[model samples]
Target chain A: MTAPLLEARGLRVTRIGDAGPLKVLDGADFTLERGEVVDVLGPSGSGKTTLLRALAWMLPDAEGELWLDGSAAAEIGARVWRTRVALAPQRTALFPGTVADNLLAPWRLKVRHDAAGPDSGALRRALDSVGLDDVALDRDAAKLSVGQAARVALVRVGLTRPDVLLLDEPDASLDGDSAAQVASAVARFAETGAVVRVRHQRPDGTATRRERLVAGRIHGVGDCE
Target chain B: MSEAAGVVTIEWPQLLLAAGFMVVVGVISLRLALGLERDLALATARTYVQLFVLGLVLRWMFGIDSPWLVLAILVLMVAAAARTIVRRAPDAPKGMLGSSFVSMALTGFIVTFAVTGLVVQVEPWYRAQYVVPIAGMVLGNSMNGIALALERTFADLDARADELLALVALGASPWEAAAPSVRTALTAALIPTINSMAAAGVVFIPGMMTGQILAGADPMKASAYQIVVMLMVSAATALGSVLAVLLTYHRRFSASGVFIERGLRDDIATARAEE
Candidate 1:
């Protein structure tokens, strides 16, 4: 049998709190396959964001057994692992530049220098796919509205073309139509790649499987209804 | 001691008259309830005592004319400057005394030696009279510059934590992630030195130039020395700021290049507790 696209076992995270070390995630197990979208449901402060950051290797104190395309994360290295498993955090943070500049920001990193950079036409297509067709590429990203910025962020993350997209509430600030566009964007990505989406509200998109995180443990909530 | 060179020496008893001027300022503070009379008196006393001790030490060193003695004095100055820099920047990570000391010692000795050895071309290179004062000046200025850079670096790091994390999430290296904060801190540290260069001899006579003139040196000669002092101070400040940032910026990241916000804070707290 082919290995899953991405897998995590015994994922643990410890963050320093006001009193002492706080155990945020403990022994959380997960798996994703090619062309599958998994929705992670959790209440506030249930370690959903921490789990995604840990999977992306962005948390310094996070430890786990993780594999990507059957290779151990330790063997793959953090830099290469992150390039394959991109994360879109819940809060929208755009670098200081025009929309097009923000979209191409990742390509400028040394780690991404080897990857094929997207052309202008590809950028336009990604924008169109995310319902940002009306927005000008030259517009200052800081001037974009909350919903417009959300779409732009989604498009930015999609342009990187990772094997697994760890999205943290990509539709939190989006309107109904924009939210639908985001769901479609995830669906399109799932057609080729895999997605692990953490959501507080149920999105319009359908997932192949659903799981809820409670107190840092993953509990299966059955397949998509 | 000689008035023929146009030098004016104030008698030792005349300093009591200078003390009268302080009484005027002290009375004003007393009337306004400014609560600065005690600090002012203590500071005045320290100035007198410190200068007297420095004068005795310099006299003794110049008589010995020993390079080892000069080196010892220079090291002592750098150590004191580093301690002051670390103490002034209370918010910076702990155990920075070592880095600051190295930054100050490296830049301080290099710039001072360059000025005295190459520019001034003082005979016997480590002349206590020439080297000690120059080294003190470099350490004094660069100490302030390095402290400012370190403080600004940590402050900007905390303020731009989210932006830094965003870049890290995109596979940015530690240097790439901390680039913005480093740039801002370096700029902040260099501004005072740049402004001093701009204002020298025009807005105000610099301290070194004033001292040379008061010692009966020609105005033109004093101006030349002032120019060299200004340039060397700027160079020392720039080098010290860069070195400080280089040593401390990576403290915000892990060995594998993760931005450890919580870990950094805990480490800082631990350092403080140990202190």
Candidate 2:
């Protein structure tokens, strides 16, 4: 019984709304194993984004027991936890620079200061893997279309080399072919690490299991239909 | 009311002429229904009352010339300035009084000290006239800088929430995620000071220089004092903006490096409810 790559126990997020405290996520228990792609399906406002944000420790108001590699998340710290468990949020946020700069952004962070950024060759390959081989490395990222920026964001997070990647509606802006390429890229990611993606589409034939969020809790939806 | 050295003296009665100028403005506002009559009247009243009170306080303090009293007055001025910043910057996160106070106090004390001691070489260093007035100028400018910086920081952070979170998701520290907002805020806050320095003599004579000249001082010496005052104001504004931003930017995040969207609003409410 090897430990799960990433696990959340009794996770709860109580956000303050105009009315008052709104429990966005309550007692969410989840597990991610290596070499597996899990598709998290939920309603439009069923805390899907909140789950991924909570996993990445983006919500300071959130409370939970998170375990990574059999160690408590408290011991690993949020910065380290985020490095190991990256979340590419729903909105494709690209910095105001060339694509190369956006991809190299993770290494530029103080937490990753000691690590060297990927060379141009590695960056080209990462983009190639995400079907962005046509996008020039020196091209301005802000000029990229929504679909291109989304793929670039995926590559950027992927370049961080996390043990688990959480994608929040990553394919929402993507076309059919581009979405397929993204699925393949994520599948390649699952060959060594793991992925938890929130998408409206079906599993894309890569997700090994499917789970849907219901009223702030995770419930198994059997296997991919 | 006595004239000295070619300077025309304006007695208390002469200020009625100045009031008449406001009356002309108020009459226009009333005729056009601009509805500024009340504000004009209140501002006119406050100008007279506030300056009169300040004159009385300065006379008494200068007469006393006690170092303790000087220190106490400076502290009170800084405290009031800090409170004004906290109140003016509506978007600032809670618990900002300490940072505002510390930033204003440090800038006010250090700049005034340098001007009076090293630059002007006032004998007793803490001479109430030199120290108090210089400190008031420094604190007033720095307070505006700090308040503007704080307001800009919070607004930028809220506007760039997604961008900030993206950085955080990429393993950035709180400071790293907030660097852009801080830079933007500091630049915005320092623009007025920069412009004032650039326009000090060519565009207009600064108030200090005008006052010195009107008081029968040599123009060359007045220019020297005005130059020092200009440089001192710029320094105070820059230092105050930096300290205020640095001390308070982390309030946007948690100890675990998470970016709080509402900036401790929930935590504050929870604490209050618990109490």
Candidate 3:
């Protein structure tokens, strides 16, 4: 395989506890092809979110190196890598603004490429796809319900159109219906070949691969089936 | 006592009439305050009553001519005010309450000494007439300033924490996240004193200068004291406000540099938690 779109190797995370260094993630390796949607399943403390943060070039305290295609995350050029890799946390942290502004915030970031506001047709299509109306674009984002905010967060990231999107438990807070909507948004983004990474806890509280999160550390990549 | 030395026999009748007018102002202010349903009025009246009693005590303190007696009064005033400020700081750490008081009083003293001792150069720095009033003005104003600064600092640190975390996740250091709100709180806490100084004589003559004049100080002397007091307040208010924010922001970030759960939160949680 000629270097996947995103690659992670030798990732480890530990925190100092009363006893000693409590290892959270030990040598987790990950790779993603263009447009692959990988569901990560792990126990509560198996460091799933930590892995995503490490890949995103965040988690300053955690020791990891991420290669976006060929260049190291550190050397990949901050603006370039940021445009390519975006993280949408599960909480849907949207700012205080109109829904349209929330949908277009990443464009304001110097790293973003989508300077032209979401085309009116694309805006309507995206909103309609997510079961929102054109009127929602004019509503104050601060007054949005959690479900609305979650959708708005997805729409904003979609507007950015990153290469590898790290979504840590993106649907954790939503109800069944809201979770389905969020999952649908993720699936649509996945169709465009952006690597979508997600984490979930298993029934037995042990690490399992919902997709390929079980590959390097626990060696259970085929378990998602 | 002699008319020849230009010490004209003081007119007690006129002085009594003047005192009665001041008393009337205080009383009518009290009535208006109550009529307006301002709870601050009762507290203001209570303060007035305390000051009236303080006047009686000071008269005896001056008669004794003992530094120890006068020193005792100053300490009592500082302690009481410090307690009040500390009590007002509901969210401040258990350890900071005493330190906040002592530190604010110390800030006031440093500023007061600079004005009266160095600039104004009263004969003795501790002369009760100058030292007491100057110290009283400095500490009193600073108590308000520091109270606001401290309260705002702690409250801000604990609230708006999501913003702090957002900045952190966005590659800002923890201190950087707190810098915006900390700056905001510090400025808010200092504004009352600053605005009063900025609009002095234009908005309303400061009560201290007016009181000094009514108490028989020369108008020029009263103005001088007022200027010094205002300058000292400006310096002390900044000092107290900065110290307050700096110390409060210290607890906002964790050892791991993460914005801790409640460590940097504002009042939002408490309100929600109460609910």
Candidate 4:
């Protein structure tokens, strides 16, 4: 499918513990088409995080060859690679500045900021789309709750309109309604024809594709979708 | 007593007073480490032994002066300070020790020499009396500043790895991503030294001053030395912190500039006092 928007091959993540190298992501391969959501299901200790991170081209320590869109990971600059694939980390990370400050985030960057930053109108539209309004722009990004902040982050990433959104357990910390909101936003992104997102799930939660990670391997890509 | 021997011999009394002060500090500090009493006791003993030994060496080097000996002592002081930083910042990046050593050496030498050679101009430029104390003060304070700075920077990095990763993904340079977080910590950690410098006079007199007065220096002269000491500390603290933090980036992060938590041993409650 047009070489997929994102591709990862032979990805492995390791952490040096007292014992030895603890392999986390072992030989995981994933190809992401435009606007598809590939939920990565795994029990605790599975390599869900490592796999999602690899797809974002942000896993510096993970062993893998990641390609973005049709370009090889090594061939593209980080700014270009990132602009194409944005990661909505499960952890709510708001820039230390104000709400408006975070909304205007890309404007601070020398490379991606110049090309990707939308004007004020564009930013307002993105925030409004994410159910945020002009009032949130002035608030301290650090002060928001997980759900509110996550939505704001979604809006922020949407400003860039990445070709592939790498979301790691994006549904976490949200109430039923917020989870639906987060899911809908993600669904909207996928519908726009971006590449796949390797999403992690809270236990007993539901998604279109249920793939469990056992011993660092994706054992089930079955008909759960 | 002869009229010719009209000297106040309170040497023992004076030394006892200083010993009393040490006891007071030890007693107070013990409370904080009550949970680990054995470790605390050992650390206290080690500190006493180390400081007393340092006192003897300083006494000799300051008196029977040899330039080579003085320089050697200064080098030893820098080395000791670097080692202290390594012990203090166990959780930092791997090259943290070497980074602390080199950067502290560079900054300490520059500031201490500049103050002695140009600012204060001790004629020999390496007088043990001046150089030793200056080295001790500068090296000691700089080492502390670096340790605090390094610890704060890396801890912030650990907690905010996701933020850092996001920034990196956005094509932000590795330095750019880590710099702000590191800078926040570096600035906060430097405040103690800065506060000391700011409060040198009105708030309280420093240890060097109190020591000089007890050793029979004129109060005015002691004050002068202190002013110079505070200046030296200020310069060394800033330079040392900035350099050590900048150099640490190389050791603590992966090729993609990801922070390696195992980069160094920062949680030194283990080394400081074993369970």
CA lDDT, every model vs. true structure: 0.86, 0.89, 0.65, 0.71
Runs in model 2 deviating more than 4 A are A16-20, B1-7, B267-275
lDDT of 3 by residue, B33-104 (tens): 745324444655676578779788767666666667656766777787778777888876655656665666
lDDT of 1 by residue, B97-204 (tens): 999999998999899999999999999999999999999888899999999999998888777777777777788898988888889999999999999999987899
Against the true structure, what is model 4's DockQ? 0.38
lDDT of 4 by residue, A1-225 (tens): 367777778887765546755677778776666656667766655777667766666655666788876788778865567767777766667888887788767657766544656677776767666556544567888788777888887777766777877776665766776667666767777787463344544532234455566666666576444
Per-residue alpha-carbon lDDT of candidate 3 for residues A80-172, written as tens digits (9 for 90 to 100): 665577767666666657877766655554434445667667776787776566446778988887777777776666666777777777666
The CAPRI classification for model 2 reads as: medium
What would you estimate as the lDDT of candidate 3?
0.65
Ranking by lDDT: 2, 1, 4, 3
What TM-score, to 2 decimals, does candidate 2 have? 0.95
Once superposed on the true structure, which residue ranges of model 4 sit more than 4 Å away at CA?
Answer: A14-23, A133-135, A175-184, A191-193, A198-225, B1-9, B13-65, B211-219, B261-275
What's the TM-score, to 2 decimals, of chain B in model 1? 0.93
Residue-level lDDT tens digits of model 4 in B151-232: 8887777777777766766556667778886788789878998798788777998998887776677778878878887877
What is the CAPRI rating of model 1's predicted complex? medium
lDDT winner, 1 or 4: 1
Taking the tens digit of each residue's C-alpha lDDT, what string does model 1 give over A63-167? 688999999999999887888998888888788899999899888899988787788899888898878889888999999998898788878878888999999
| lDDT: worst 10-residue window of model 3 chain A | A201-210
- In model 1, the Cα lDDT at residue A113 comes to 87
